[model samples]
Structures are given as structure tokens and as C-alpha cells.
Target: MTKLPSVSVVILNWNGLNYLQQFLPSVFASTYPNLRIIVGDNASTDSSVEFIRANYPQIEVITNDNNYGFAGGYNKVLDQIDSDYFILLNSDVEVQPQWIQPVIDLMESDAQIATAQPKILSYKEKDKFEHAGAAGGFLDMFGYPFCRGRIFDSVESDNGQYDDVKEIFWASGAALFIKRDKWIEVGGLDADFFAHMEEIDLCWRLKNNGYKVIYCPDSVVYHVGGGTLDSENPFKTYLNFRNNLFLIQKNLSFFHASIIIFIRLWLDLVSLLKFLYDGRPKHARAINKAHTAFLKAIFKTGKKASKISTARFNGTALVNKSIVWQYFVQKKKTFNSL
Candidate 1:
């Protein structure tokens, strides 16, 4: 019998007592031997720690002093876990009993595969792919992240078209599986990222370091998207726009970053106008705020990105074309269209 590597499934919770209650059972039922399940509580005021302690006594709980957001919180907790691999699972995800084995098998086959994500379908609409990460995440020429089965808001139905094992530009953080050493080598998630697009930035760094990020469709999970923050929340809007700029600036070449940032600002302006036109001033303001924060961050992040080794892989994994143009101008909604 082959001895499986030690696996730790760490769920970061932030006032998600209900979600944990609803989803923890399925996670507990995971069939992977040599598995350790842990919940890292991000200073929840709602007694989430107490609830987990009482109900799931067998599960390990690590509590942070305050809410360090997603990136920082996970970094703090993951530092203590000395496992072979760590699955940075969202509190809201519901995993199948056998989800861990297939992903582990795939990772074991390729030592260079530093990060991987399973097919993420919607918890509500089980047949449809979810928003955060569908099949696997990829980037456009301009640094927009989209999935193989999801483009912008148009999520494709799961027909197993993307079931093949292959390399991808990024893996979704919703249910990310990463080698413990590889994750530590890249310095884990960038704490500066706070939350949004942090995983993409980490994966980009992993690629720059000559590692692979892949999609393993054999393992699947259901994610209840927007559990911590809803899409309409202005703060979420601000984070998405702001973090996206930081992502590209910190990874791409200076020439590419400058040009793409300029273009993205203009596109953001159009989105702001659209928001105002739709009588949603809050959203418009959020976009405005994101730009302001991004501009302020440019100098600091620009210097840092330049210092990092930019040994990029010339691969077809990245879409050389503009996904925005493909989706809006040509009205190509599905992943197969482009």
C-alpha cells in the first residue's frame, strides 16, 4: 500500500458560523487518508470559534487576534501547519467525499505543478459553473482573469468540456491546492493584496519562478459565491479594481504594465459611467475609489515588481486577445466562442 502524503484542509472563517455549520459536514466526510482538517477563525465576533469547538470538536481551530482579511489571515495560519500540502478552502465551499484524492494524485504526478483548482460549480445551481473559479483561471493580454467555463458574468453549464488535465494561468483561491514548500517558496499570498486577486498574483509569481499552475477537473466542489462580500458591495468593487492593477503592475513587464494600466483606467471610466447611467452612484463611486487607490499604489508596487525575476514562460496559456472586446463588441459570451 502506498502511503499518502499528509494533507491539511484549512478553512479560513470570518463570521461564517452558519456556512461552517452547513458545509463542514461534507468536509468532515472527505475520504482522504492522512488528512487533517482545520478551521482558522479570523477573529469572528459571532462566536464562530465557540460553535466550531462545540460541534466539530475533532477539527483543529486556530484563532487570529483580529480580522487580517483573507490573504493575511491564511498566511498567519498556514505558517503553523507543517503538512505536505495545504488546501486553502473558503468557508462556504461544500466538498465531495472523494475530492481530495484526485487532486492529490494529479499534483503528485507533476512535481512542478505548484498550484491547482478543481472544477467549481455553483452551490445553488449545481449544473452551472460558479463565478470565482469555473474550470480554471486564465488571463487575457490586458491582465483580466477569466475561467475556461466562465467569461465575465456568463457562466457556462457544466457539460465536462474542460475535463482534461492541463496547465492554466491561475488557480482559483476558492478551493486551491498548493504544495506546502512551493507555497512557502513564493512567500505565500501577498499580504498587500488583502483579499481580491491575491491568488492570481501568487500564481503569477509561481510561474515566474518556473512552476506550473494547473486545473484538475476530476475533483469538483460546490461554492456558494459571494458569501463574505456580495458583488454589489462598493468595497468589493473597490478591491477588485484596485487589486487588479496591483496584480499586473507587480507581475508584468514595465512596458506592458504601463500600457495595460492606462487602457484599464479608460475601461474603468466607461464602467463608472455605466454605473451612473444605471442610477447606481455607489458603484460608480467605488470604481472611482479603486482608481484613486491604484494610482497611489503604483510607485511602491512598481519598484517591487521590477526587483522580482521576470522570467516569464512564453506559453499559449495566456489569451493574447482582449477578452473585453471579445465579450462586449463581438458578443461572444461562452468560452467556446473565443
Candidate 2:
């Protein structure tokens, strides 16, 4: 028999036992034969660790003592990854039977491609695309995520627009594949992010190093969307807020970063005033933390660090625009118009 290419699937869990109920069965059922699944449990107090230990004997489980959050939990298995490809899948996602090989096939064909993601559909609203990622992910000059088939909050239904394989700004960390060495090369996901935007940070570094991120729509999966964290929850808000800012700090050049930061700050103020006007003080916590975290991160990353390039590309792709603000406004308009 010909030797199949080795692939390691890394699933990070943090008190996500409920998610595993739907996730593990789907993953271990993959059609690919050359596979190793590693479940990194971030010290869940729930029976998540035990459930996996008892039911999924084949899964290699790494149980940490405390919750390292997303970055820390994933970093636990970096030293243990020994495969051609490392798939960083969220515990909440359930993969289709043949998802892995199609992605692997695409990577096999392209030497320049370093990362890839599949078309993610929503499990709850079966006809809808999930919020976090859809098809392939991209970064605006301002560091906001826009996938080829998705724009901000408007995740268009799988309308065959993403059938073609092509380059992208980033791949969704939810069901993403990256070359093992490339993951190690860019230092994996930024630990500073702690949760959201880490994959964007990784892809930016990959692109900076002259590698391409791709969306392979043939690799399909259904995401429950909010599994371990509620979409409206405060910590999710904080992480999403803080991490997006941290990503800008790590990647953009000083002048470019400043423009993006100021735009975000001004929009956030508009959000706060709108919230207060609507008497929704409860929702302000996330935006408030987003506001403060950026300020602190700006101070910590240092004004001088903006001159640094985390990775080197043959070309410097810079833009003059407020990517997040424009996209969010458009997203709102799209949502309202719908």
C-alpha cells in the first residue's frame, strides 16, 4: 500500500464538554486513514476530559491544569505535532466525512499555499453561513476579516460563489489547516490574542512570508456557532475586542496602524453613544473593554514597535482606509435591509 500523507488534527477544549458530544463523533468518523487526532483540554472542571477518555479511546488527549484560553491551550500541543499538516479545529465544529482529503489535496497541489479553510455552515440555522467564518478569510488593509463568500455579519448562504479555490488573507481557525513547519515558523497563533483574531495574526505572518492562505470550499463543515462561549457573552466580547486591537499592533506599520486605530476608536465612541441613547448599558462592557484594551496594548507594544515587521514579504501591501468601520456599517445596512 502506498504511504498516506500524515495529518494531525488539533482540537482545543476549555469546558467544552457539550460541544464535544456533537464534535468528536463527526471528527473521528473522517474517511482519511492517515490521521492523528489530539484533543487539548484546557483543564475543564466538567466531565469533558473524562468523557473523551472513556468514549474516544483513540483520541490523544492532553489535559492541562488550568484554562490557557485558546492560544495557550493550542500552544500545549505545538511541540507534539508531528505531521505534514496541522489542522487547528474548534471543539464546537463537526466536519463532513470527506472534508480532510480535499483540503489536503489542494495543499498538495500548491507549494505557495500555507493555510486553508473550508466553507462553514451554521448548524442551528442550517441554511445560513456561520458568523465567525465562511468560505475563505481575508484581511482588509485595516485588519478586519472579510471572506471571499462572506462580508462582515452578512454570511450569505452557500450560493456556489466559493466553489473555486483561490488565495485569501487568512483562513478560519475554526476548521483551518496549516503546514506544520509554517505553523511553527510564524510562532503559531499570537498568544496575546488569547482568543479571537489569533488566526488572522497567523495568516498575516504567513502572507508576509510570501505564503498564500486559501479557502477550499470542497472541505465542508457545520458549526454550532456559539458552543463554549455565547455570542452575546461579555468575555467573548472582551476577547474579540482586545484581540482585534492586538492583531493591528502586531502586524500593521506604524502609520498604517495609527489610521486603523483612530478609525476604530471613533466608531467605538459612536457605538457607546448609540448604546446609551438606546438605554443598553449592559452591552457596553464589551465595547468599553475593547476601547481600554487597545489603549493599553498601544502603550505596551510601544510606538517604536510599529516600525518592526513580524515577517518579511517581497512586497509591502498597505492601504489607507477604515476597514472595520466601513464593513461594520455595511454589515448593519445589509442586516437591516434584509
The lDDT leader among the candidates is 1
Q: In model 1, what lDDT does residue 47 have?
A: 78
Q: Write the per-residue lDDT of candidate 2 for residues 1-338, one digit (tens) a residue.
A: 86777999989988888888878999999889899998998888889888998999999998777887788778876666789898989988988889999999989888888888888888777666787777666565556666554565566776676677767677788898999988887777666677887888788877777887887878888887767677667677677767777777667677777787777677667767776787767657678977787787777765434544646552322323444555655443222132
Model 2, position 108, has a per-residue lDDT of 83
TM per candidate: 0.98, 0.89
Per-residue CA lDDT of model 1 for 186-231, tens digit only, reads 8999888799899999998888888899899999999998998899
All models: lDDT?
Answer: 0.91, 0.76
- Badly placed stretches (over 4 Å) of model 2 are 303-338
lDDT minimum window of 10 residues, candidate 2: 329-338
lDDT of 1 at 283: 90
